[model samples]
Target: MRQNPERRTALTDAAIEVLAEQGARGLTFRAVDQRAGVPTGTASNYFPNRDALLTQAGRRVFERLDPGPEAVGEALALPRTRASVDRLMHEMVDRITAFPSGHLAMLELRLESTRRPELRAVLTEQIRANLQENIDFHLASGLPGDAETVVHLYLALSWLIVERLTLPDLFDADRTADLITTLVARLIP
Candidate 1:
């Protein structure tokens, strides 16, 4: 059957929603079909296997979370100063908060990856690509860190963002802002 891009996107999106709401175990083709409100076998038509479906769902989350050129330009075009660092930090937090479900789905995928090495490898590649893209963006945007330092900073900020969003009661917005500000100060030189 000829692949329909729109339909594939729909299936992947549904998969993300299922993964977010129900975690990895609930991410069945039927569940995705139900979530998508499509006919039975619809998800299977797009993804022949569990691995394919899971991988596509992961990719879809990244696609949805990707900041387009305008946001990138706005962040990058700022003067490389302490205030610019603050704006960039705010941007990162805003983005992570904006897509809570996607981030949660990513966390689910991380846990699921541990049980399935194939899933682990797939996620590893995706994460590596994402990290490299961030590092590249950092270099282009003139963030103050070497490549290794930037990677570490990304990892740290990722954990903080995940924690802050997934457990809002644990850290109020002001505290989260304070944490981000301090981290940005240290990480951006």
Candidate 2:
């Protein structure tokens, strides 16, 4: 049976919202059906199975986050200051927190993919793309390799810090950026 693009889009959007608000572990066919204002039968008609639905939903999220070369250029173009870097890190954290379930779901997908070849393949591709984008951004910024390493470590730490802090209050964006800038500068000549 053919699917209506509009309906499929609606379902996908609905799935994202639920995943963001409720975490992947809490996602249910019935909840998505309600969120989409469609019947569970309709969702089943479109996705057919749990893994199928999750893969599609995860794919959509990953696609949106692809951060093409243009995005890398933008990141590189930003001033290399602690405030700027901190703001960037905070914004990323906000996004992850806002889409709690999607993040959790993706983590689950990552773990499951460890034993599932197909999923592992998908994850590998995504990780590769993401790594490339980061490398391009770092190189374009003209930062030294050691400084870039610090920035990478800082970024990971920032994510963990943001996860532990309350929304909007975890860290002052300007201050964080300033801190990153100072740290990076110290690493520089």
Candidate 3:
């Protein structure tokens, strides 16, 4: 594998784009190199095989989707109310949608993981950790929700995101935002 961290990240990111656009079958080293605009075989240097590339791409999508400290701080600052939860959910939707490729690649990875047990394990671990983090944040933030509430919100909002990303025309922007508010109101106490 190559020792250049930046190049490796770039290749992984490119792989994400390839996965998003072409699905797992279309993800090839040459395609990744072209997407990254690097010389041919560059991705192969960084990833020994397709599975390694796919695994790294899965990790990279989460890294790219991380909302960072600023967003977390902003969430914590909000009042602990159902309306606040609504606002937080709206912000979450906006944040996830902003990186369309990352979310779309995540969907692809979820599908691919079904065929590859190793990939399935990696995604399962990462997703479970992320879910736990969300649950912990909701509890610690004093948000108007328990762990179950958080889990329901997570499931609902995730499907909403899938709808928004895969079939955006199904719901317009205002309608989608309205749906988030409704979800928070109904799910939170």
Give the number of the best model, judged by lDDT. Answer: 3
Residue-level lDDT of model 1, residues 1-189, one tens digit each, is 339999889888888889889999999989999999999988887777998888888888888888888988888778867667667767877887888878888999999898889889988998899889988877787766668766766777788888886788888888888887887777766
Instruction: Name the regions of candidate 1 deviating beyond 4 angstroms.
Output: none
**Which parts of model 3 have CA positions greater than 4 angstroms off?**
none
Candidate 2 residue-pair clash tally: 8
Residue-pair clashes per prediction, in order, are: 0, 8, 0
TM-score of each: 0.92, 0.64, 0.98
Summed over model 1, clashes come to 0
TM-score for model 2? 0.64
Q: Which candidate number has the best TM-score?
A: 3
Q: Kindly list the per-residue Cα lDDT of model 2 for residues 1-189, writing each as its tens digit.
A: 338988877776677677666766555777788999986667777877766666677677666555567766676777775545555555555555555555655665666577767767777787667667656666667644544564565466545544444354655756555555565455444
Question: What is the overall TM-score of model 1 with all chains considered together?
Answer: 0.92
On TM-score, who's better, 1 or 2? 1
C-alpha RMSD of each candidate structure in angstroms? 1.6, 4.4, 0.7
Per-residue lDDT of 1-189 in model 3, one digit per residue for the tens?
Answer: 788999999999999999889988999999999999999999999998999999999999889889899999998999989988998889889989999999999899999999999999999999999999999999998988899998999899999999999999999899999999888888888
